[model samples]
Target: MCASFIVAAHIEQNLSIRKTAAIFSVSKSSVQKLVKQQKIEGNLEPKPRGKPRYSHLNNSTASLREIVAAHPDATLLELCELFGQNTGNWVGRTAMCNALQKLGLNRQKNSEK
Candidate 1:
C-alpha cells in the first residue's frame, strides 16, 4: 500500500511531496490525489469492479420462452426472427442461443431434416 509510503515519507521522515515522489518513484500529483481520496472517501483501497451489464435480451424472457416452447424445432436464426416478430426486439443468433442455454431449453436435432 502506497499509503504506508506516503505516511513514512511525508509524516515520519518529513520529506516534501516532490522528494517523496523521487524517493518512492511516484508522481507528486499521485500522492496528493491519493491523500485527497483518503480524506474524502475515508479509505485508500481502490473501488471494486462494477457489476456486469444486463443482457440485451433481458426484458422479453417470457415471450422468448413462449416462442421457443411453441417452436421447439426452430433453429437459432429462426428463433431470433420469431422472437423479433413476437417482441419487436431483435436479438442476434448468439444472444438467442445463449438465452436458450441459460433458460435450460435445447433444440438439438434428433435426425437429419
Candidate 2:
C-alpha cells in the first residue's frame, strides 16, 4: 500500500511511468495498473475481488467430531448420511471426507498385517 501511494504520488508529480517503476523497484506494468486503478477509483488501494468463501461444515464441526467419536468404524458415506441426519442438510461424500480430514479425523479401513 505504501508502494502504491508512492507510485501514485510520483505519477501525480508528472514522473514518467518507467522512472516511477524503476525508483520503486516494481514492474512497469504494475505502475501502469496502479495508475489506471487510481484513475478509475480515485485511489490506488486494491479492492476485494470476489465473494468470501463459505463452508457448509462451519456450523457442524462439533457434531461431526461427536459423530466420528461415536462411530470410529463408519464409512465416509455413512458419515455423510449421519451429518445430514444431524444437521438436516446433506453434503457430498467428497466434501464430507474433506471436512473430516480438515478436522484431523481421517477414517481408513484396517489392513491385515
Candidate 3:
C-alpha cells in the first residue's frame, strides 16, 4: 500500500516511471502497473494478485482418511481412483499424496527382501 502511494505520488510529481521505481527501490514493472491502475481507478491500491486455488479434496479429507485406514495397502493411484469413484470428483495422484500427508497418514513403502 505504501509503495503504491509512493509510486502515485512520484508520478503526480512529474517523475518518470524508471525514476520513481529507482527512488522507491521497486521494479519498473511495478511502478508502471501501479501508475496505470491509479489512472484507471483513481487509486493506487492493487487488486488481488492471482486466482484463488480451489481444492476438491477439502471436503473429502475424513472420507479419505477412513478409506486409507480400511485399505492401508492401497497405492496412491488406487486410492485416487477410489476417491474419484466414491466422490465423483477426480483428483491427481499428487493431490491425493499431499492430502494424505496433510492428514498425517504418510505411506511408507515396504522394503523388498
Candidate 4:
C-alpha cells in the first residue's frame, strides 16, 4: 500500500511511468495498474486478495474418523462414496483425500482390501 502511494506521488510529480518503475524496481505495467486502481477505487489502500476456500467435508470430520477407523482398508474412491452416502454431500476422491489429510488421518488402506 505504501509502495502504491509512493509510486503515485512520483508519477504526480511528472516522473515518467518507465522512470517510476525503474526507481521502484517494479514493472511499468505494475505502476500503471496501481495508478489505475487509485483512480478506480479512489484510494491506494489494499483490497482483499482472493476468495475464501470452503470444504464440503468440513462438517463431517467426526464421521470420517469413525468411518476410517471401521474401514482402514478402504480405497480413495470407496471412502469418498461412503462419505457421500453418510453426509449426502457426494464429493470426489481428491476432496476426500484432502479432508483426510486435514484430519491427520491416513487415506490409504491398512492391507489389501
Best by TM-score: 1
Compared with the true structure, what per-residue lDDT tens digits does model 4 show for residues 19-97? 8877777788988888787778877777789998777788878899988988888898988888878888888888888
Positional deviation of residue 110's Cα in model 1 after best superposition, in angstroms: 2.8
- Model 3 residue runs over 4 Å out of place are 1-48, 110-113
Better of 1 and 4 by TM-score: 1
| Model 2 TM-score on a 0 to 1 scale | 0.55
Runs off by more than 4 Å, candidate 4: 1-45, 109-113
Point out the worst 10-residue segment of candidate 1 by lDDT: 1-10
Which of 1 and 3 is the better model by TM-score?
1
Q: Model 3 over residues 13-113: C-alpha lDDT tens digits?
A: 98888888788888889878877777788875557889987778987888898889888999999998889888899999889888888888979977899
lDDT of 1 by residue, 15-109 (tens): 78788877778888987777677778878787679987666687777888898889988899999999888777787988888888888887798
lDDT of 2 by residue, 70-106 (tens): 9999988998898889889888888887888888886
Of candidate 4, the 10-residue stretch with the lowest lDDT total is 1-10
Ranking by lDDT: 3, 2, 4, 1
**TM-scores, one per candidate:** 0.63, 0.55, 0.59, 0.54
The per-model lDDT (C-alpha) reads 0.79, 0.81, 0.82, 0.80
